[model samples]
Target: MMLKRVAVIGAGAAGLCAAKHVLSRLNRFAPPVRVGTYANGRPIHSSMYRDLRTNLPKEVMMFPDFPFDSRLNSFLPHHEVQRYLESYCQSHAIRPHIRFNTAVDSVRPVEGEEKTTTWQMTSSDSSGRQKTETFDAVFAKCHSSLSLSPSLSLSLSIGEVLHSHSYRYAEPYAGQTVVVLGAKASGLDISIELVKVGAKVTLSHRLPRITYPLPAGIQQSSPVVAVEDDGRLRFQDGSVSAADLGLEIQDHVMTPLYHFLTPPAFPSLFFIGICKMVCPFPNFNVQVQFCLAVLDGSVALPSRGQMEEEVRRELQEKLARGVEHRHLHMMQLEQWDYCDALARLGGFTPLPPVIRSLYEEVWRQRGVHPQKYRDLNYQLVSDARWEALN
Candidate 1:
């Protein structure tokens, strides 16, 4: 039998890390169905929007093993982040393996002799060329979210409800009143954009009233209660609104991943960078390493039933504490512990303490100085501490 290797088709930071380790150890590991990349070639469904800047600082968000360029500011615009990604790809020699301009059609499992499973992957390229290949295992690199951004099948009946993920620009929403959900990161940014385009926006969330000054066209409302017909919205504080459009936004990519990564039914299939309210790149870096550890059998996973039970218990605990069902993925505070546990279980170096210090600091500063928090810079003084710069 010939040994097969994993071909990381996506060039995201997480994918690159997976490739990096896989390339280093050819003999160790490789298996799958529905394992994919950022396929479908639907650039329009991308979550990026014009005029968007990263909510996370570069110091905390950079891949744990790969650092961002030192010259860039702590806070970065979307273009700068893209440039950093390009630089990382070049530095790590990751672009060559990625089949750009191609879309994955389907990945189905084929049962071989002895009950062994292999994945049959089908994909199409830019010229509409199609090909099929087999692999022992798979990695799902697809851009997934509970929101409509990546799930092409999901549709909201309310014609007025819009997904902020598909909003590339604000001009199209001009003169319309939009009610935005989840005032953490994307929601506020989109609200700002809508206000600039002469659209009235009601920024709704469960957090305490934001103290920062906002445009007259934008009003910060209490937590949302219900989505009524005719674009009417109710708030937990008992205020009602009739907005022209409805939308939702949050801090990170929304994906339905099991606790500590990997699906319950298919442990052979790996998923990286699915957790929300996390420091994206750092989370990806840790997750990819942990997945590799599991693949190599260094860290054993619980039985499928046990894994599902843990997920259920985690969700029920959150619900008991009154966590809104929609916000279950928001693991902002739990991220530190989650990453630490993965590192311990995988026998890998944990993220530098400075990362957490700076992340929490930025979170605090963001609420108090939403307008000017990005203006402040910070330098990592050591593995344990970060100091602010003027």
Candidate 2:
């Protein structure tokens, strides 16, 4: 059978998972589809930051069939995650299908019609030769929410501003004062990591409370009340010492770079993840489910009614019934809404579902049940103000 050709750009977690899911469906039903992956560098998983570790536990971060080894310990470091990605490619036997060193420069539809897409992919081989290729369907698996710290305006700055991305080993800033900004996982992690290396660290949280790791091994703080000059970080109803300035924290997610790739076409692209943005897990889960549905023709697009209907059915049956399955639901929904808005604005109707059973499976796995907080003054989880319910 001649398969429908699908090309996935970016060889990261989202891209890899999309390919794996597509391949599984194709193999099972013999769908007329072919899958290919394109990446700028070799198909290795290296994070932009050096001190990076998967925020989620290894169990949650890894694929279902390919779990990380138990002997490797809990939190997987950046280098180890990269190695695991290589292993995932090898185990899935998709290495041959990936064209590494092929960086995508631009992505636009083919000519006038919107059904087809052509990516202006540029890549340099190991021999340092550049080449380009155009593919049918493109999935941008590239990392979206970049962590580069914004340049603090000179007027507002009391000290040096740095992003969690530039942070590596703490040795460079030893014996200096630092104020960490943002209050997300990266900022919190940096604050602790720096403190160990002898730099006096003060976390400058913009929010009312800093999200700390549960069970309180470390990195957990009381509450940040205010920021004091003379380089002191004060907690709500408590106080800490001041220090000499090495680094000052700034909110990167608040910048335009945080919304970099939110284009108004094939809207599924936006829900994957925002660099430092946090969303309720179930919302994200809905978005992922929607992506699978949209790509596989299990859920139709353009009709906001259809997407919302299917989502409602699934949430009531699968997601809301159990706590374990609920985390990814919101995540999935976020992606769906983002993509749907973009598609409507771009005048493209989403592909309707051809496989009825996949829709059933989405409902079954996610289960049918109403949201636990459905009565909290919100119309539906699909509403734009759904985040307020959280």
Candidate 3:
């Protein structure tokens, strides 16, 4: 049997893991090909910021098969993580298979004999050279965009409105009063950075009032709902903030996925790392292994109708548990069980129990000391155990 021709798009964390696993199983797979749009002078989609350090410790964030350098800090800067990914790529000899500076334009499924899918993908390099390729299996990223109300969309007319996605460094806005929106990870990190740079920050959010001791220069306020007629900011509680400029943090895409792994109708196409509130690297590890099993016929998939029914039933169960529709994909506590189920179904070794235990400990610490949890460190030892250090 000829090895399957597989195409993996987006050479990020998940893509790299998929490629690594594909290369290891030579009998059932060809050399995997990857296409990514993230290079210098190319379209930027990465969330890395210049001065950002990971909120989670490296012990909890690293891939199970590959560990970070033993000498580096537990909470590493963005560049360190990038370097680690580069090292992983080199260690696995995955660089030669990637198409650098290439962007995927479209992926259309061509049905073949017996209802099998052959993916026809079109891509263009930075130099505008286009190429079309057909592959036996395709792994890609899912794209979604959030819909802003007209009033909020018009708020962009205000003098300076910068989304955190575009924010790389905090120096340019020093000494300026900035209104940061959203109180989640990026929002909180950005707020703290601005305050350290002599910038006055008004943190606006929809969540309950933060009880933690925030930095002195930061002030908390209600979520920003709209812009005033004069271009000032209006909050959800009818309050307004007057500031020199503004900074907002928001996700570009929001859509409901039928299943976290792959669509029932498109078993040959897998979307990885789309779930929110996940331990990313380990999550990618489990997902790619499961997808590989699906591709090589080790794990038999259900019929299309049955898959669709399972999806509906899963969503209904989540709703019955009082989970909001918007949070259907937020699998914070559910990820462990999900990983276990996938491992059992695919006949792969499950993630070590130490990872989940350490992750849960970090979550508890984050609740008690949101801003200081990073000061803690951990060392993973043999026998699925981790030791906490000061």
Give the best candidate by TM-score. 3
What is candidate 3's local distance difference test score?
0.81
What's the CA RMSD for each of the models? 4.0, 12.4, 2.6
In order, the Cα lDDT scores of the candidates are 0.72, 0.45, 0.81
Model 3 residue runs over 4 Å out of place are: 37-42, 142-151, 154-157, 251-258
| C-alpha TM-scores of all predictions | 0.85, 0.57, 0.92
lDDT of 3 at 59: 88
| Better candidate by lDDT, 1 or 3 | 3
> What is the total number of backbone clashes in candidate 3?
1
The best candidate in terms of lDDT: 3
**Which digits, one per residue and each the tens of the lDDT, describe model 1 over residues 1-390?**
454445454545666667766655557743211222444445542577778887778888888767778888898988988888778767766566677766767878788897656777788776778989887667755433334532122124433666777677888889987878878677887888889889988898878788877778988888676656544666888888776677766443332356546677667667676666788888877877787787777988887788888888888898899987766776888999999998998999999989998999999988777777889877888899888878
RMSD of 3: 2.6
Q: Say which prediction, candidate 1 or candidate 3, comes out ahead on TM-score.
A: 3
Task: Put down candidate 3 lDDT per residue, 111-224, tens digits, no spaces.
Answer: 999988899999888788889999998887542112222225535446577666677888888998888877877788888898889999999877788887888899999977
Alpha-carbon shift of residue 200 in model 2 (angstroms)? 1.3
Off by over 4 Å in 1: 1-4, 7-11, 27-43, 113-115, 142-146, 149-161, 206-208, 222-240, 250-258
